[model samples]
Target: MPSDVRRTTLLTVAVLVWTLAGCRTVNRGLTEAVLDGEHARQWHIRYGSQSFYSLGDEGLAKIEFEGLIDRERVRVRYQRGMQGQAECVADVTTRLIEQVELRVGMTITTSTTIDLLRFDEPPQNFDIQLTVEPNEFPLPLFVRAGDESCTSILAQNRSYPYVLMHELVETSLAARAGGRVLPDVGYGWFGLGGSVNNYTRWFRDGLANYAGYLACEILSDEMDCPECPTRVAPLLHTSPLSRLATVRTRLFSWSQSSPSEHEREHYNAALGLFLLIEDRFGQQTIRDILADVATRETVDGRDLRAIASQVIGTDVKQFVADFEFPMIGGVLTPVTRALAANKGLNVAEGLLLEFVEPDGPADRAGLRPDDVIVAAASAPVADTIDFELALLRAGRPASIPLAIWRKDAGTIDVEFPLLYPGKD
Candidate 1:
């Protein structure tokens, strides 16, 4: 919640006050400061909402750059040249944003702004700052993390695309909800506050982080969040990936309200609940849940639990309880010590299907009893843990791929349909 709260968009008034101090301001490569009076006036007119207001004269050097991705426009304003990132950062970040939009079946067409700020002295020294206004202005994107500039972050983190996507997706959803359901949340990126906006912190961050990881996974062929994904390191000891859901996602008494301390990495719980939903219903259900949030303006405001439950035709509280998510499903076994020796597998080279329930996910994927899964989701599975980890990273899919070694068929690939619990 604190990490998400760092996005508090005090950009406007903060910049105004800082610039008004009238000395030791950033003049590095900033076009605004050197513009002639008339052009400066016109320049301020165009971008004054970004806090370039009331500057009669000053010296600052900044960078102006723009790019398009998947037909959406992106603009970046910076106090220093991005060096090489200036060429590809916007395109990469915008594409990640586009992926999140496409995944949710929604598109926020508003142009986005990325601010790369560096404060060299006083009140803040050697720090990074973000500035933006989505509703008040068209720039709905801002990212702040420690003292690293956005460009610096990109250069340092290969997974920076995920960070950019997280900010954009969260802001976009906030904008859509603000524009529609919670009109009282005010305009601009600051629209993320209110009774309803309380949902913005944990749940919103979770969903955004989930969406961002998905996009990152798709682009990189793996989920590459340096600090995340490891939260799932405890390769599930639960049922098989081919199991049936014994419990359904129906609303319960406890889910009537959204809990504030609901911080089990909303990302983790959400990923579980949603993947279960995806396995049971379909991936389309995930899109439906988000779409419902964006365009929905019910009497209860934008309640995620209700919206997800409604979409999944069940409830959301099950996952919220102590941040617990069901890992219940079918079962797989590590190639037994004897079996590994018999099969010449040195280090848990594969998993054996102990029981593939008839008409279950395994059966639907053409898995049969005694089958050996050598790989899952394109990764080699050396044990039950590997297979489960693969399944976890793959999320829930109707047709996740599996490669198995059958006594009769050798190594063959199968498009496994991962169904969830409930024959319903």
Candidate 2:
């Protein structure tokens, strides 16, 4: 009898241990499921100052989450705030998830005084799936090229994916919507320090891959021929600023003396060559072409320039001349240094004359048009004299600094570190 009792006790203990382990596993799964659900149902919102280049005075965002619980009650809650202000609205609960979403929408307006710049498309609704009591984590979902979808992780964690997707979609869509036909042709605008910065952010959040990123980097300034389909486009290219550096010298000349109609036509022709290569060849081919060109190798018994001539039946110089057109207005101008005569440095005639020079110290320093000069060499010059003083002060050799104000954009305080001037 005692032996029978001992055996029964052992069996009961074993069963209890197994049941406890199962319960723990179920509990952990449930927690993860809940977290994911919270992430998915939340509408991740972000906005910037509507006008571009207003760095300091832009309104940040306040986040909120609204969702249904067990397919019945609606729950709305404020997730977080920025800069110590709690901008969230009063939380509300209801029986419908739709109502929860609506209520959350109402609170968004109250969070900011200025009209927030919203994404072209924001998630207005969610497709909820019902699962067992203990839910499981979902697999990674894929986004199509130029298309994006928000997941629970992005929504709940307040991840930057939503903002990044907006940029990607906006950029791709904007390029498509722009006058340019070939997608690669749009690469010129997208291949800049700014574009690369945004691209990196997008890649980190799983919005982009190697191809698009590299294309943007190589073609930032060559707006005429924007497309470049290559592994570089998807992969991060080392220098987004490469093209920008070369562009500075051309800026002053382009801006001061208008390109002759003939020259303009030539530049436009070159742009056309870019468009053709981008449209006909895949990104990999472009990469191969660039690699061959860089290494001074021959393809099919011809050098890069020669191969280009064979493929297009025209030399690089001729091809550039054919497509080149007069410099179009409204493109970004290269910046260069000008010292104030009395207070701010005067823009040197040469620097001012050049429309753009990509890497010139003046251009790299970010000077804009119609900027008033205030000081040079960190010294305040107050005497308001005639034109001679202004010109003389501008020529001073000490590394200059200037405070300038533009009409639309605000004032900028800048300094240019002088380098040994190359053969100018």
Candidate 3:
């Protein structure tokens, strides 16, 4: 009887250990599948800001647009009879790049090759997959494949043109800002000094979406090209700034837990900042910001902010603050450093009203154009950013008291009502 009991106990213990191990194995597989696959590659392209200049090794060129462009120009070689649906979007991408070339101040002036290709008959009951023919010659573009046209696959995926937009913009801007072919200067210590180029990821990804939307809107109205496909159109509406505000988490710093988490922070925050730049300055200013960013490989987060501040003529943090809280229903421009010195404000921290919408919350609350915001909620506002932070600290109240400085009337206290609900 004692021997029987011991055998039973051993069996039970063995079963429990095996069950636990099985659970762990399943979980480990799931984690690897999710993190180490296509999702992982997406992070690499955007956050890693993959360099097209150096593709000496096959490892780096295994990406979506890998080896798509040869050393020289925008040339895509497809199989014969490949002109069906694939060439449509390919044409659109080419024309869009041409327009971007004009906008970013590069004329291209080189011949572009777009060949539509389709392979011969495959085995019966077999589907022929389209792929890119590798460029051994000086051809401009090559798509990877095994007896298939990759462009056809892209057109069917519905993310074809919009995804192509950003890549083209990035490539075009980099080519023009630096040169058609940029040389690789390795970063010191595991490429650490330059790999975490927060600015590159921020600008590359944000401007991609920012400019992509505008480009799509234009093409929709004018060219009837496939800009945003039906399925993916909704994804483009995500406002980077408002999303973070809703979550109540400010941008993540470099010391955060995971690289992916930090990368997510960079994407939304950068887009928010770019939207504000477009609002305060203009579209031209955003282009100019990109022009500066494309040339520098090591411009980190702070460097980007400073460069944007110089171009937009305001402290970049103000933009950060602008999206950090609810909308104040008016556009605010930072008081220039010289003007702030004349006004005795710290770092020239003050906001000048650029435009107040008629009958909007600002207009209704007696905020006028050219009126400077000196303080909010009885707290001194060092700048537009400070004003937003003050609003956030006060819980984004419906109505907050503000001290306004008008040129002729001097300082006046007013209850500024924030009626505009933040981005949806």
Candidate 4:
């Protein structure tokens, strides 16, 4: 065949193969191959490259990248197709290190690599999963994507920055302490074996949330006008003290509540406690606690309490006791009973409003603290459980009649609209 004819024939065959690949799963593999190479090379140059291999156990291949921040080489790795995201994460992380160091006035000598993963679809059972390699020198930090569609932009903005800062702070503490800092017990009762002994999930979570709040403040200020209000959102719907007061009963045992409740009540309670500590003792107290923990060879609930007491120059027991029981007489009791009795309100068969989130549907409907909820959607509201069930049964954004009894005012009826916070 002539040279031109031969060239034309080869081009036709290539186009046919490309067209066929476009219509099948094979196209994904081809595209991923191209992306993988491009991303690996880019990260390898931008952040120092370590190795390229399949994350054998994880069933994913990853490229490792490293960069220097304050004499520490921060490493980051990501699976294919998330190179840009990883780069953004790395940049944010570098800034976090500086912020943490400035706030704590401690150098983070420990080395760590942040691993990023993206999912095509949300996992059926899990949201995001973050793990830290406690024993490794250059600690391996794993960050996996959650259901992005389900997460609000506000939440993402708040949480992602917080997670980065929280991990860095924890890792920094671990580096100084010479090992992994055990999880917090939060509000676990004293005697439960596995239940009480397990690390307090809320402590770290609250700490992370606080860190996220701080990061938001920093970023917002950095990006905003000089006189603009702080960009960080409130950590909880109500005041920390109120949150702690309301959830006192549920704190004793993790098994008593669902995961969602744990996230809301316990985590917020923990954040509230930290906020209280910050309010009473100033920011240096937090630094002191972290520094003290770093020096300690081992840490436990008692150790943490002792550190808090030492730093604050007050009995940590009083704080715990206060959180567990906020009554004036030092009696440990549920907020419902305490409020009904103290306020001289009849509460034989009604859910007392311990809190009414500002601007929430309940608040918008004129609900207030100490108000007794008699009925919702014509159903008797005997307790919180009943109220919750009624709300669920009422479904989303339903305007239903609510019967409330006020001490000064007579029995009042109002239409309450049930709504989700971030949904509407």
Worst 10 residues of 2 by lDDT: 106-115
Residue 399 deviation, candidate 2, in Å? Answer: 63
TM-score between model 3 and native: 0.44
TM-score pick, better of 1 and 2: 1
Which consecutive 10 residues in model 3 have the weakest lDDT in total? 134-143
lDDT of each: 0.49, 0.30, 0.52, 0.53
Candidate 2 differs from the real structure by a C-alpha RMSD in angstroms, to one decimal, of 24.5
lDDT by residue for model 4 (79-135), tens:
545555555556655676678666654555555565554444322232333344553
TM-score on alpha carbons, each prediction: 0.44, 0.18, 0.44, 0.45
Q: Distance from true position, residue 413, model 2, in Å?
A: 61
Better of 1 and 2 by lDDT: 1
Q: What is candidate 4's local distance difference test score?
A: 0.53
Candidate with best lDDT? 4
- Which rank order by lDDT, best down to worst? 4, 3, 1, 2
Tell me the RMSD of model 3 versus the true structure: 18.2
Best model number under TM-score: 4
> Model 3, 326-386: lDDT tens per residue?
5666777667657666655443446878899787777877988878888999897644435
lDDT of 1 at 416: 74
lDDT of 1 by residue, 1-424 (tens): 4755555544454467568764345343233545633343333344423323221112212333343222246765543344334335566656666676777666654455544433331121122333435532222122233444434444333334555556555555556545222222323456653332333333444455566556655554333433322222222212222221222221121121345443332334434444455556776887887677667663233376677768766555554342222232346666655876776544444677778766667776778877888888899875553565576567545567888888756789998765443432
How much does candidate 2 score in TM-score? Answer: 0.18
